[model samples]
Target: MTNQTSEQFWEERYRNMTGQPSGRPTGKLVEFAEALPPGRALELGCSRGDDAIWLASRGWQVVGVDISATALAVAAERAKAAGVSERVRWEGHDLAQSFPEGMFELVTALYFQSPIAFPRAEVLRRAAEAVAPGGVFLLVEHSTAAPWSFKSRTPFSTVEETLASLQLDESWEPILVGAPKREARGPQGQTAEVLDNVIVLRKRPA
Candidate 1:
């Protein structure tokens, strides 16, 4: 199997994709971020920049990181068309190889899972480290994959399991950790019940 974490693999995948982003931010992001004040935000695996653009529109300066250069280019164009081009920046990196620099007031990894093997825990730990003091780190992962997903039969890690892997210290305050069920819409408009492991943490201010 080709390494799914490689830049080439993701670039190929994005190059074949059709249409633009849905323009709707994930429900979890909107729910949690709406109350917080605007600040620098980092989005890990920002596929088409929908969520990043949404944050930018909300007065937050956003840095969207993706593994696919093609996706970044398309997302940048979409951002420019949205009239929030100055609020968002795009970068391409293979998380297994490199990560973006600087800290952020908000760091998010939503549905950041792959069908193939990868160093996901290590990447997420690095993501946690990028959160500035008193910043929020939100992770939403698939506890139960959607029917159309490539990982449909794969066993998912629970909230406890993921937290154990993260090895967060007392300096991080857990705001929310649970498995929430939601209705997920598939690519062809099919809907199914899916569960997500949601973890929201805040780094203690110095």
Candidate 2:
């Protein structure tokens, strides 16, 4: 298991892992954001930068952050390859220690779970605080374990729990907060049904 005290764990994981970028954008992200006008965006734990690239391609100036330098390196390559380098900036940050500076129009933490326990809820609260008025904060988490997945068996926090942790007032409007079902495929080409906890909130314009 990886530990937050050791950035090398993550650095090594990305340095050794072999795979292609999941080029397809998160379905939930596309479904909800496709029509929204582009603006500044921030992605937490942006693994290989696919989501950031997608946002950049859509005209959103993006800052993609992760703790792993190797991962950010690959993400930088992808951004360059996609010709969106000018619009996207890849940043390395141990989010548990600090966050990227600047407010954003759209903030996301898609599948940002870590094997090692970290201050995720607190980080999320900060994420919300960084969202500009009229901006959106999007969170997508796995609701349950998949048969083919290798993730920790830790139970996922519910949308209600997550929302509660933020302690937002009426100034924030909940767009969606519930677990939705979806079909998924395993590495072996096996299929199964899974549920995902999705939360979308927009801050009321001041």
Q: Name the top TM-score candidate.
A: 1
What's each prediction's clash count?
Answer: 0, 0
Task: Report lDDT (CA) for all predictions.
Answer: 0.90, 0.88
User: Which portions of model 2 miss their true places by more than 4 Å?
Assistant: 2-6
RMSD of 1: 1.5
Residue-by-residue lDDT tens digits, candidate 1, 9-96: 6777788888667889999999999999999999999998999999999999999999888889988999999999999989988887
Q: Write the per-residue lDDT of candidate 2 for residues 1-206, one digit (tens) a residue.
A: 54345377678778888777778899888987788899999999998888999999999999999999888999999999999999999889989899999999999999888767778888999899999999999999887878777676367777788779888989999999989998887766788999888999999999
CA RMSD per model (angstroms): 1.5, 1.5
